[model samples]
Target: MNGIPKGRHSGASKAECRPFLSSTERDVIRLVHEPGFDRWLDQIKATGGCENPVYLAGYTTVQRAETGEILRHYSTENEPGGRMPVRCRNRRERRCAPCSYLHAGDTYQIVRAGLSGGKGVHDSVQHHPRVLVTLTAPGFGPVHRATDSAEVCRPRRNGGLCPHGLPVGCPHRHPADSSAPGRPLCPACYDYVGHVLWHALAGRLWARFCDGLKRCLASMAGIPRSRLGEQLRLSFAKVAEYQKRGAVHFHAVIRADGPDGPNAAPPPWIDTDFLENAVHSSAATGYVQAPFSSATGERKIVWGEQIDVHPIRGEHFTGEIVTPDAVAAYISKYITKSVSDAGGLDQRVHTYEEIAYAPVNPHIRALMATCWRLGALPEFESLRLRPWAHTLGYRGHALTKSRRYSTTYGELRDVRARYASESIGASDTLTDAAWRYVGSGHTPGEEEIARAVSHELRVARESYRERVTDE
Candidate 1:
């Protein structure tokens, strides 16, 4: 009677007359009728409506260290399904928009603190000389380019053809969103090997460039390289961004702090011009050697010719001068992007068949194939190109900073976590915490509800911000 219609069918059997329900519909009905449905919804709200919330079973107890008095206690024994939900905290927007939003906000704070000064950094540091530096990769071959204006891509006086009989010049204009921007003029002419190899060596090249910069600064100050730290400290926050061509570029906020650190002022001699000159000198000369491989030969890695250095000003709007807020916003805009933004896969491709079936453009597919083929070589094993074929062999975190740059992501998260719950406020406290992963993800109906919750929360935040600005 529960599943079948109330009225009896004249000729049909009981099973044939039973009401039909999809798996997701049945799940939704069961979940709604559960005793802890409301409590479970509250847990979802706490996670900012995470699309892939991780389930955890755990308990925490806080007690006074001296008197052994219990201060606070939390357990998941009474939670829905004996578990709790937590944010996945993925930085890639394509995978988790809510987590990426939080990450981008944290990144903005980190960059802004190093420039305008906040959080743990002293506000006086705003007067320090800081610059936003952009380092690019050298060209491997000619590719179609997008333009903001009505300008032809790679215009040539004479219509020429490559060795493969493909047109060498692109007389057609491409808008910013056109799919043809990143494709090579001739696939055979493009240096796919060099592209992936450069991606593999990008992190090392950045390290070399930073070292060279410090040396250059020391040389300018007429001091020994080892003693340079005694007078001036270089602190930086950098983020990597993938271009339309799938190559990575680095954007860094480099600040010259006093030897004592951010709270102290830099030496009077260290000005914007001094920093700019050092950056140019280091980028022009710094180089790193790739691991020797008989298949690809030894390659020297260096920053490309297109280097941009902009002095960060304290003023918000000065027309020509870049501002701290502007730099922070610019860096935050790209912090959440992954290879998927450039028409590539977000997950690893373990097999050639996976690469073949991946939903990526032809240009990106070729780069992934190149990484896979090169990863088989004995000498290239250290680079681990195969595991990272999805990212075109790029190795390293998308965001990195010096020890003294600013407050860390971990510290920011800790502060948020504490504020979200009741604070113990005890100077001396003993805490015991144990947690374990139970499971992750949601059923189809749960996913639908989570997406709606996420959207509603996002809108509320934007509306609240608008009201505050108006006030």
Candidate 2:
């Protein structure tokens, strides 16, 4: 500070004032003397307290719209670390837990809004038709599984053995935690090729099923198939969940809407009951024929016989209890999930050797091998099995919804950004920014604080939700 008059700083520098700071803030106080620490903190805070931030070297200037005058200017040139950091914004819990937690919350809000009517969707949509449907993959092989506690896995007559020399039946009443479900009863008898192909084409199967459902609804309504497009539209949100048995199952929230969207109601003739029947009938008959393979033979894929449909009742519904809230939560919960169960890598495979060394269980390795094996055949190249071997052959969006089904993730993020800016009273006419990648992550001490902040945010959100529920 100048002797004439103390400026922004304490007359005695922060170094002299540091002893008064609390224990928790000491780590931060250490940086008080550093010119850019405060600005770095501002940027980190802007990321909503990111765990692992991205580093950048940048400068930005905002100008007034009415006049060619600078409104605000920022640069990372003076930072103690010589770089600015931004949030990673990753949604995978494994990569960034804090960001993923935030994503899961956003997903919950999006689904709930779609279900109960919010986020620009019409409130009358509560009266519109909706159903929760679960479609399962057909059994690729009779793997040794304890279907229930009461049923012994593949009970055999006098402990007989199969031609492969493995036991034909398992006598153990496998517990819920037992790994038997994902393993083939006899490896030789297992249809690994079919399993991988099914995973690859699961999305297509659902698409076909949707088309079939529309046609069924049209037939029931006594309209021409071509006219169905003009009369009614189908909207849905679906999530793919992996079963303990290494197969993927789909849970979908299907909504019927007019061609215009959620605001326009479906033709009165099409109710939830008709939708349910169509779902069951279409799932039963719909099929996708995979490329003919001499080894596994031509396979026609269809939904497993086990299909569950629940009527999605809205806030005003009293006729039948539909767990729309629970349905929304279930689907949202899986948006952050990946195929860890199938033993495939979360990232893509680079070479055959990487797949061989993947941390997957023995069963998953076999499935991956099958994927690689089939990916090589000239006929199966269209399926792109080799690159997706880490996914056990499945390739589709983890979460997908029809454009009219609900608001988009992008819109949600934009709203969040606007709210954050408004809270700080930020405005600009013209903004120019120059940025360069520098580095990422944090020192040990900074990481500890970031984790504590992340935990507090989680607890605070939970407490707020509880209070609202009580109200």
Which tens-of-lDDT digit does each residue in 172-242 have in candidate 2?
A: 77776776766888888788887888998898999999999988998999999999978788888888887
Query: Per-residue alpha-carbon lDDT of model 1 for 24-45, expressed as tens digits?
Result: 5555555666899879878887
Best by lDDT: 1
The segments of candidate 2 whose C-alpha lies over 4 angstroms from its true place after superposition are 1-49, 78-80, 144-154, 173-178, 314-321, 423-428, 443-445
Number of clashes recorded per candidate: 0, 0
Local accuracy by lDDT, each model: 0.87, 0.78
For candidate 1, the per-residue lDDT at 232 reads 92
